[model samples]
Target: MSDGDPADDIMTATYRALCTHGYADLTMQDIADESSKSKAALHYHYDSKHDLLCAFLEYLYDRFVERTSDPAGADPAAQLRSLVQTVLDKPEDDREAFETAVLEIRAQAPYEPGFRERLTRFDDYLAGEFERLLEAGIDDGVVDPAVDPADTATFLVTMLTGAATERVTAGRSVECTRRMLAEYVESHLLTDATEAQL
Candidate 1:
């Protein structure tokens, strides 16, 4: 939907409702309540809850892509930091609730081809971004040439998603996880040679 479209408004409302009521308890009425419009207006845009949810999923995916799309320049370490910060820098309560809702949607991916496709694409997009930064770092001699960019990218993505999942499921502190990731980057991804040069 276009930026100013009613569908967009409905979808935004759906996000708020999901954050508040969650996927299991989310209703059209609840979504409408969160929006600036009425239930009838929401129904006018979305024929069914499933239809609206699919649109909501698309909106979320697009937002994620937008957030993670570009690294800005040739600084791979900075690129990595930006990506990690974007994921973990949310305010505490909001971040937890948002992660919980996303996990709920993520668990449905297997049963829903639409979800599975979007999630898979998003994963690949992230992995590719990691690979790009790693390769750049190697080329710049900051990352060890011995490290395989492809393999390291995979590991990085796993670490990222794992940290996020841990926060959601176990209520782990975001700052703690963020520090661990930063340390992991320092110890593994950035070489002693790189540090010495710095």
Candidate 2:
């Protein structure tokens, strides 16, 4: 690698390669080309394409956590909106390709234990975060006390996953889903007083 950390360089390359070729058609050579490293170097770090992609999934999850784990707003309602927006936001240039690649990987999760395990971690972590936010909102008198945090968290996570998948598979716009989620928050989750503030 260049003077920097090789692993970081490789992960960046993997992301680029995935965007360009997508998971179904991706190869180690594609990653090597993006990284400017030899195929042997790629293999030195990963035994096979499957292994490399498994590691890449973990890396992607870590980056997702880093980007989203911080609370961006003072109020729980604002934080919920921020979190959902972050999930739906994508860079304009590679949005389609990158989302397609991720969808391909998610599709493979059904048959691939490694992928299933990694992807499950994403769902579990996101659900936990959602639950935490809902509980906080209730405690602060912003969310409806009748809302069950666990159930609501699961519903929100499922909604998000559906939005992501529909965007790639059906060429659906996520903005509609985003609006629906916002409406759901305003009507279903937030207290009447909290809704007025929003």
Best by TM-score: 2
Candidate 2's C-alpha runs over 4 A off are 1-3, 91-94, 193-198
Clashes of each: 0, 0
Question: Could you say which candidate leads in lDDT?
Answer: 2
Clashing pairs in 2: none
Q: Can you give the TM-score per candidate against the true fold?
A: 0.81, 0.91
Q: In candidate 1, how many clashes are counted? A: 0
RMSD of each: 3.5, 2.4
Per-residue lDDT tens digits of candidate 1, residues 58-104?
A: 77778778767784544777777677777655533354565688788
Cα deviation at 196, candidate 1, in Å, is 12
